[model samples]
Target chain A: MQRVPELLVEFYSRPGYLAIIRHMIDTLCGRLGFTPAESSQVCLAVDEALCNVIRHGYDSAPDGRIRLAVHEYSEKGRLEILIEDDAKQVDLDTIRSRDLEDVRPGGLGVHLINEIMDDAVYEHRKEGGMRLLMWKRLPRTAEPAKANQEVDAGES
Target chain B: MQGNHEMQVNTEQRDGATIVRPEGDVDLSSSSTLRTSLQEAHESTEGKLIIDLANVKYMDSSGVATLVECLQLSRRSGTTLLLCQLHERVLSVFQIARLDGVFDIVPSLDEALAH
Candidate 1:
């Protein structure tokens, strides 16, 4: 049996590199049973997490390293992602999403992750830096309704 | 219709509004460029500033933040800012943030121009 594909990558914390990561996640999510819209949200969540790592964890230091690991459990219909940065650790409690009613420009990254992902948590890595663990509930199959419609059309 | 070759966003003055259009993905790196364009549009236009998102297929939180900043700037300067032609995907980001109500969103450039 072919094994499930996993993504384990480490790269410098740079804004330019985010597009590559976003593309990877969007493609992987689509192949793993997410609709295009769902894939976009998942991709955005990951992008926002990486942005946080670069902005808050690394203090915009381009030389810092960011480790990203993505795992999938097809049977459980879940996708797990871990984003770690080798920069200053954060106080987990302080990483709160801004109040949406405030109508502001900044502080929406954490809110987006929490809104899109099924589960998201922040923790300080004992070794150094901070780690963000995120979980997304993947669809068991991509566009079941469309598949049913196609089958129905064929039978008729 | 005209564009800055170095940036993803293009700007044009049509009717009474300065229309700023950004193509492709808007993320951390591109949001700054988008912000600059929006700010300039707001500053140069005494009538209205409209952002046409017809070509923007993907946008992240940073892009949303940039728009919010532009909205605030437009309000502060007494310039009317409108967003039009948002893709369903890009529009969802604003809906998720509940910003759909905060900005003046129109269905097309004509609607924005009319507003």
Candidate 2:
């Protein structure tokens, strides 16, 4: 098995912490040579998973720590991310997609995660709580830095 | 990953385009504001619609769906809908949903309108 770089952080399931989480994801992805689009997807998926853990897993209890483990393999062109929370249990089999016509403005995280990742798994840990495992494959060949450079040049 | 607080949505018009700006966290609690704002934009003008997401700190699937609905409505109405000023976080939601190609996304409102 290959060792993958990881980042772990815990926050009270509150909206304010989302900004920090997003920044951290972007910084980490940038360092790992992820494209802008890929970086965005990872951040969103991770954020949604975290949101679920807080909102549904704990039922908005506002206690305990939510652990995030991110792994990236550049050579294999693969990324794996695991988010775990000990607050409550999530029914993996019961997970359902949010209706589009409902229009009330929430409850679509699971479906979004499933759509982006090559694979998404939900498991209830023996110790307690839920773990969402998400994975995505990178492009087989890295695109030349020409486009990135062009954006950078245009920014200045 | 943090709290489940709600998000707030606001609207504005710029250079013949309607811009919907949302603030706070977008989830089940706050998705209606976004939906209402977009619907209002659709009703108010036949002009292009631009979602300014810079101030939008967070968005979940509920939020993305609202944007998709707006896109669909625009398509039906023959109005251009652009998602502009994408915060890195919000942009992630689009990419995760494989919606990057589904909407017209630009770096900023000016850029979206200019095109």
Candidate 3:
């Protein structure tokens, strides 16, 4: 409900766009006070989600539309992003990641997203698609330069 | 071999080890290319394929999955697989996924080769 900066990006569901999307997420996280490492992890989470949308949601169709809405809460130092796809919706009950003990490929994407993000919610869009919302609580170092009284107040 | 400018993979042979160094961010976009490069490197030698990740600044689960595939392939081929010089960010991904326990990680190429 806070007044936050919101940005929406829409692109084709394709593997080639993953780099651009990752860079965008990383840069935005950095600018919003997330440390490089934090930004990188968030980048990974978003990348994983988008990859899922492009792969599973669209079934690797490449032409399916994908939309990402990023909400930047400057006051609270929290970032929330919503990923939407126009492909067929998936059952939320099946959103859970596979067991790590499996030690296999192709299923780690969902696990990585769940581990990196503080909160992740999946929903079926009314228009017939899937929507994923994720948010993370950043470190106190969210402020690059809080005040002269703050020293060694770096990211954890 | 390079993959769409997002990632470029380099391979080398040393001490009966095939070292694959991927320079760039490995994600869904470039992981397939990396897989190809790794597979080719492993095919060229009976060595322990060493994934030298010093140059990789970032990697996604897809990248990790690609490595997992190679690990399975190496096992089928009766070869050992090792990862060296994983950057902190990339290392954390493996750690989070508990893959660190599954992989033989080394600090450097020399150590990987020594093994």
DockQ for each numbered candidate: 0.42, 0.23, 0.51
Report the C-alpha displacement of residue A81, candidate 1, in angstroms: 0.6
lDDT of 3 by residue, B1-115 (tens): 1123468998888887788899988888788999999889877977578889998888888899999999999888988899999888889999989999999999988899998
Interface RMSD of 1: 5.1
lDDT of 2 at A82: 80
Query: Could you tell me how far off, in angstroms, the CA of residue A87 lies in candidate 1 after the best superposition?
Result: 1.0
Give the winner by DockQ: 1 or 3.
3
Candidate scoring better on TM-score of 1 and 2: 1
lDDT of 3 at B13: 86
Point to the candidate with the largest TM-score. Answer: 1
Instruction: List, residue by residue over B37-97, the lDDT tens digit for candidate 1.
Output: 8877877897799899988887878889899989888888888989999988889999999
Chain B of model 2: TM-score?
Answer: 0.89
Tens digit per residue, CA lDDT, model 2, A1-156: 334335667677764566578768866766667776667667777777777777787786667678877766555677778888787675676876665444433566877777767888889899998877888885655333343456557778
User: Is candidate 1 or 3 superior in lDDT?
Assistant: 1
TM-scores of the candidates are 0.89, 0.61, 0.88
Q: Model 3 off-target regions past 4 Å?
A: A1-4, A74-77, A141-156, B1-5
lDDT of 2: 0.72
